[model samples]
Target chain A: MGASSPDLIVHVDTFARVNMVYEVLSVISVIMLLAASLAVLITYNWRVCVLSLAVQYLAAFWLINLDYPLAMAAVKLVVGWMVCAMLGATPVDLKQPDEQLPGRLFRLLASAMVWILVFSIAPSVLQWVPTGMVILWGGLALIGMGLLQIGMTTFAPRIVVGLLTILSGFEILYSVLESSVLVVGLLAIVNLGMALAGSYLMTVSGGLEV
Target chain B: MNAPLIWIVFPVIVSVILFFLSARRYLVVGLATGSNLFFVLLGLLLPIDRLIKLGPWAFEVSSTLMVFGRKFVITDSDAHLVVFLYFFAAFWFFGAGVVRAHRLFIPIGQCMVAIAVAAISVEPFLYAGLLIEVAVLLSVPMLVPPGRRVGQGVLRYLIFQTLALPFVLYAGWVSAGVEANPANQRLLQQGVVLLGLGFAFWLAVFPFHSWVPILVGEAQPYVSGFLLSLLQTVVLLLMLGFLDSFAWLRDFSVLSQVLQLVGTIMVASAGIMAAFQRDVARLFGQAVILESGFALLALSVPGYQGAEVFAGFFAGRLLALALWALALSNLAADGISFGFDHLKGLLHRLPLTSIAVVLSVFSIAGLPLLASFPVRLMLFDRLIPEAVNAVIWVMIGCLGMLMGGIRTMMVVAHSQEGWRFEERLPPAILMAIGLLGLVIIGIFPRWIMPYLIQLLDPFQSLGVLMILPLI
Candidate 1:
């Protein structure tokens, strides 16, 4: 694609053959993404949260591949899993006696609302995004839930995870729009950097060390 | 050597070396200072795509470096950016040891600068968002050293800065579409909204500025000051690039008005907020925000003059912020609270440091015979007719920040401690240099103002109004 052509840069990968298995997988990926994000929102167990986060990257990878070349797309999955490993290595202490806890049911309801909002709005928003329905639903759900997670907590770990989730969602959307190697590399760096930063924060902030 | 190699790769390599010797404060500062000085010289002496002859042997430096199918290109017009960034880095690095900043300050700060350069040189501007994100991540460790608990301020800052990424990426796509067909009102609207949101979050323009003061309150003074100054300047530079790249976006009639309004709001709100802050460090943050507002207002001026005035603010802002941060570093060395009560009558104890703090504050407030006065005047001259109400609000904002300075001064002066200068010699000398630089710039704005204004010359359309009017 010419840089200043003033023409739309169509993606070659978007022309992939539509198969039933891939279609089923895409639907499963969106569902899995929603479940993973919801799990992250309400779960107190750091282990479960990390596992849900891992599942998120997995779902993200499945959908992102629809738009990006398989090899370039797998970079996200690798980086996301690596980020999970780094965070998992860090001991996270989520329990604070002095902090007031919002009821779990309230959290569940809030997340459910986020799911409904994103899933409902996905079709309307799809007019702008040039990707498949799988990407639209999965991306919106991750963004909404990521925002909810960020808004609901001040804890360093939770905030970091939320940021990562949001980034994953954004990458899914951006992959369809951009195919620049530099953009991909820089984003991968951002993900790894954020994870390192989060671990550093946890280490310094007195979170439990594994 | 190419621009990226000279500005980006060299800095990263040096930063890695600095990391190994980071524990040795003096050595790290010395190396960083010297290397940054080298970079400034390189920026001054080296011309991209032009041959240089030194002692008979000659070599031409290329502008573009290809890596992994991507181009990191810094053209000749961008050379001044190298000059500006490193000169300030050298200035701050020179004083790092005197202030007893964290050992990681030099190494991490250098890494951030390298990442900043990468953000600047990347081929497609959209790629910059992620590079900037990495830079923000690097700041976390520098701001919060070991044993220091992370505050909501840092987290908020992280999240807020991160939030700009997606909006900017999406906007890049929309803008591409708009460029293809500028007549698509719906596409244009979508582009404008996304772009505005991206910049708003990135710049922390009004109402979204809580993180600035809060982070200032929580982090070390020098670290926060350096990061804010660097990040804000780079973001502004990026915005200029956006405007320069998109004629459609620039011609969108409301862009100027929107900028002026946002700038006015940030200035007024920050000033009012500064007046109410009990903690002096938080006030410093508001001062930073006010400066950001001023830069935005400067950019809103009718023509290339606006860009010049915008660029002209750099030297003054850098000096003032460095002075302010360095002074605060000296004043808050005891690890004591930054509350007014704790700082009561501190003037008697640290006279030079106290004076440095006040002068820096007043300078940022656009006090006469200070660094910011001339550019502020240039902005007001053109801005008033267009935005009288905004100008009035800005003056009120200026007064509020001045009031903050006055309040701080009164408290520092009222202390009961016996009159004595307790500041160490090295830090006092650094503060003196900063103060002297500010005053010198203020007294003879003509000496430096023209050079600073030249920063916009590379952007052809933006530089069309290169002839600066006499202030």
Candidate 2:
């Protein structure tokens, strides 16, 4: 083969480097998403649960950025963090130190099945939703785990976190489909409303002012 | 002048102001009632997109308002719906104090109404899911205000409603794609199925309906009645909006058959279940389900026949449900048991309220002279040829509801003690007015129903699908 020109060499090198950056980021996002959601499901510590939620949103931000600019995708990150902060600060004793060791192990085992189900269904979901592989995996994973979380708990704080996680998952999937500014704004409003509603339930059930 | 600005945005602004003024309960009630009344009048009197001159002052109310690249359109055809909504809202607000509803009732109520209107009027229509979700969230505070533990009913409501959001938005997206390529049979099926599931959750169809009685039982009857009434009505109307707008979906005859099947299940289940209910609060929930059943049945009818009955259902439902809820609220205020067994001899203590309760239930059951009877009869007449089995089950459902009503009346009227008139003035008057309204509607439906039937005019293509029940 003939020697490549200097300009062509630079162009080829830049293309490979860009692909490398994407591959690295994708792996990181996948890792963060999986670790965060599993932690949320298994942890009873409120601080750990809240931190995992924030980190899950970070994974969400990365997935969303695949479709939108960093500035636009930041809406999901900011709103998700705000929700985490709000629910985390509630006066109610959300720190449920009550579940036995078996319960945590059971949740972990159940979540394993959920992950299996997500992988099994992601191919089918892709056929209909028309999103990227990373998104399909991350979005479906979050949704499946989030639903598992909601199903496992009756406490307001956990339910709200689960709802936000599911919403963020949906946002990731939907961001790739439609780019309407208003839809993004409305979805953000929904996240905040869910958090506010959770806080209200917590404060009231914890006790007084009606 | 803009139609959306007047009907949609104005209520939101009012709600915000009312939220701050809520501590002044009387002022909030007055403002909510006045604002709703104003909306009713404006909807009835003004013609959208038409200029008129009065003493050299002229203005035209435009139909569409664009914001953030999306359109909110409220046209002349939609005026009747706006009128119906606010008119019913005013009725509820006017009775707020008598029911001793929370001070937040009016403000949060107006917010619910505004969000509901937005759900109806939002363009591209897909955005309706988010708006509806907002409306659902707003209901939380009302259902579980400060000082009360969040009931399982509220939690379930939140989860079920949240779950519906994804299905609806996803279905809308799917349908949009299918519309671009109509030959995609698999995608079409998926879209239809998703939309059907979304409606099932939103409207609380049979299997998903556990939350209905639970919610009505746990929360105050007035609040539950208002929320369920608005939620169901809007969702039904939104379903109609979908039918009117989407050709591929509506064109499928399977849609009608499915709706009929679903409607029959809801009615039969609600009615049969209502018969066994001991608590009046739960009975109210069943009553709501029964009405929803009838509305669905109306849509399942061959054509415009279903639509008229459907529209008429909306008109009759508000009066019957309002009266039923109002009567129930009045009884609740006296600290009486909602359980029929424990409520023996309540008629002697609160005769007007007891009568109101029985009459409202009787009306919902489609008794001969109730507001819903004419519509129910019309629906039966249409369903007879199409699905005799449905008619049989529906009648059974109707009879079941009527049986529940009779049981309530029996409990209310009989007592070991002597009969006494212990009802106070304000509630007695309110109950009496509702009773009269139901009677008038039952006797002369045409007078009022014509107005509500026009609610379907906004859904031009669904013109053949007039109201079995408007919200």
Candidate 3:
């Protein structure tokens, strides 16, 4: 059970185990992030507001752990939490219909996660062992997550689905070690542009409570 | 100044200049269109690596412009292709000026020109996926109908493209190993599979083709034409670029087989779908999707002859689709219903639109002595010998498409009696262009083929050259 024990049944080395743990933590953090993103999207619920920021912080923590081992995981956590806290203090009820609330929240979360997958998760895949397999698995996971969110919600899921699909592509890009800095940078800009466009769409549709 | 850099920067600069001169609509249109024309001219005139540096930034005016880490490198082989992209963009910008809300037209038009320039200039084996994502994103606003269906086709398109990007990216990534001559055939296999998936998505091959019809249904006719015809032309070149630049891809028999299979399915399914399609826009979408598959299969076949045929065929498709989209959009704007029941007796009412549609359909159907004929013959001739089953599939599909065309004509012609002929006819210029282009290409296929062949000579190896005679 100890870190040095080769006798441990798992084939993973200490670093690998640490990476795996971080991966798990990353998944959990992503789930939380999705929840918070969902909440922020669904309604500016003051009661749930604190949870949203806390989740974003947790996501940053786990994501950072996948790389710079000593890198502070709490940076994103603290930042996300702070944003959430501010929102919680003065909750803005999107005040949209209750029936439509979940769908909106799901879509927003899906979009936010897509960005995270691109800027954060995808690049980190480069650091994993068996790089291609890891990248492939990561892409499949992101795709699965996106689909799950889309299937679970009825709102304008196209925007989120599109973004998620794009992230899945980023995952594949990393798997192939196509770490073309220029390409990644260009994709980043495109993703943000899409997010802006998607937001504009929701606003236009009367889906965004604000 | 670097040709590639100037080519890209000029558009952005022009767009900015035009954005400011919104008060003078015609002037802005003229400026934008003129600048786009200049890009086309530049694409034709510039050397592959013409570059201008402003401090740390390097600019090129071949295919794309690089600014502050932005690198646009159009190879000599890709010069003609880049020029074609700019030409199409210029054409669309001219059309944009005459329409209302030139806002969408200006920004997306400029962005598409940039994307095309980037697409053609970049090292094809390296950056196709990212370029595709950029193009798709740029297309979203245009593809989705305003305030309706909430970006249905755009979203589908985005997802399908996203699915495809990884495949091609991974293929390129794995093929990079070919430089080192990786010992593992498994690596090669993985790369081929990824590429197959990628091209299928990019081309809207069957089963992954839902986006095509949906996009046509939702998008404006003009924008749809740009995306399907001009954008697709560049995309075809990008795919061809992979084959030219990457020996691994050109040599992969398995990958070639997958393309053949995909093409066969696309042609058959699209034809079947079109026969049943009630919506005119969707019918166009299906036809285009099928044509795309045919083009993809043609290019994917392993040889110089196939690639050469693809280039000529693609140019023809570009012209055909552009004319078709213009005519369709004109009809849509005139409150012409696209449904079968609604289109009855339409031939008498709109002579020009009817002629354009008929001509375009003939070209698409690969009828004798039309633009698409030589391309189809080249594709089926090569592909049939390899996979007889695919040939049969395509032949059957061709029949379906033929019937679909007749069905469409019959319905539209029948609907003409009830409605009055108050609406003005579509511009005669576009019809003439479509008719002339197809007829000229059909009568003398070799006229354009030789030039395209010469332009693409750098891609032809001894092995590929050997296959040309065989094809």
Q: Using Cα atoms with residue i matched to residue i, what is each candidate's TM-score against the true structure?
A: 0.95, 0.95, 0.79
lDDT to native, each model: 0.85, 0.86, 0.63
Where in model 1 is the C-alpha error above 4 Å?
A: A1-21, A96-102, A208-210, B416-418, B464-466
Local lDDT at B245 for model 3: 73
Fnat for each predicted structure, in order:
0.88, 0.63, 0.31
lDDT over C-alpha atoms for residue A44 of model 1: 78
**Docking level of model 1:** medium
Which order, best to worst by TM-score? 2, 1, 3
Model 3 residue A68 distance off true place after TM-score fit, in angstroms: 6.7
| Tens-digit per-residue lDDT, B278-302, candidate 3 | 8778888988987887876776577
- Which regions of candidate 2 are displaced past 4 Å? A1-24, A95-99, A207-210, B465-471
The parts of candidate 3 lying over 4 Å away from their true place are A1-61, A68-141, A151-154, A161-180, A208-210, B20-25, B48-71, B97-102, B145-151, B415-426, B454-471
In model 3, what is the error at residue B254, expressed in angstroms?
1.5
Candidate 3 structure quality by residue, lDDT tens digits, A47-113: 5534543554454345433443232334333443444444344323334454775666666666666
Q: Write the per-residue lDDT of candidate 2 for residues B1-471, one digit (tens) a residue.
A: 799999888999999999999898778888899999999998889988999778989988899999899999998888878887888788899898778898778889998888888889999999999999998988899998776667878888998899899889989888898899988999899999999899888988889988889898888889999999898989989988888888898787698889899999999999999899888999999999889888888888755666777777887798888888887788778887699877899888888888888988899999988888888888887789879998999999999999999999898888989977889899889888888888888888778876776888987776553344432
Interface RMSD, candidates in the order listed: 2.8, 2.5, 4.1
Lowest summed lDDT across 10 adjacent residues in model 1 chain A is found at A6-15
